[model samples]
Target: MNPTTLKLCLMAVLSLVGIGLYGLMICRNLIKMVIVLQILVKAAALGLILAGQMSSQINLGQSLGITVIVADTIVAVVGMALAVQVQRRLGTLDVDALSSLRG
Candidate 1:
């Protein structure tokens, strides 16, 4: 790949990571937080692929990206399930509300 293309891809990865972090920090809803986490994981997968390409190991990068995708999907599913339960029992999806719960 050309240096220019590599730089662009790197910029994209950085942008995604920045946006994901910003969203995670600012969002109070559990579902939105889950979405932000997905964005962060995608950025990580992109970074891994970019590194593999730079190192001339594209296949390894692709395999790692696929693995990340699979793991993230499972995480998202579980997160959504928890969100649903929280909404059902607590009547809200706010993180602050969850903090009031006692064991």
Candidate 2:
């Protein structure tokens, strides 16, 4: 890629990471947290791919990106499942409410 293209890709990756971090910090819902985490992981994967491209190791970058995708999917599924259970048991999706609960 040209210098301009590389710069753009880096900017995109940084934007995604910033947005994800902001969302994670501001959101109180478990489901939304999971979505934010997904965004963060995607940003990481993009960064890995960009690094691979910069290093002339496209295949390595692609494989690592794929691995991140697979792991992220599993995490999302589990997070959603937990959110469902929390909603059913507590009748609220608020993180503050969940934090108050004890064994």
Candidate 3:
């Protein structure tokens, strides 16, 4: 990749990370939090892909990438299940209402 192209890729990945971080910090809904978490993971994966592509070797560290993908999938599944349970039990997805445990 040309220098400019590589720089652009890096910037894009950084921007994605920043956006994900911002959303994670600002969001109060549980589902939005899960989505933001996924966005952060996807940003990391995007950065990895960009770096791999720039190296011209095209090697994605398949073992690690696959492991990460599998783990992410598992995480999303479990998160969805938990979110559903939380919504059912709490009647809302807002994170601020979680003080019942203090009782």
Which model scores highest in TM-score?
2
Write one digit per residue (lDDT tens) for candidate 1, span 1-103: 9999999999999999999999998999999999999999999999999999999999999999999999999999999999999999999999888896577
Q: Model 2, stretches more than 4 Å misplaced?
A: 101-103
Poorest lDDT segment (10 consecutive residues) of candidate 1: 94-103
Q: Give the whole-model CA lDDT for all candidates, comma-separated.
A: 0.96, 0.95, 0.81
By TM-score, is 1 or 3 better? 1
Model 3: per-residue Cα lDDT at residue 26: 94
Candidate 2 whole-model C-alpha lDDT, 0 to 1: 0.95
Q: What tens-digit string does per-residue lDDT give for candidate 3 at 30-85?
A: 88888988888877777777766776545764545566778887898899889899
C-alpha RMSD for every candidate: 2.0, 2.0, 2.3
Worst 10 residues of 3 by lDDT: 56-65
Ranking by lDDT: 1, 2, 3
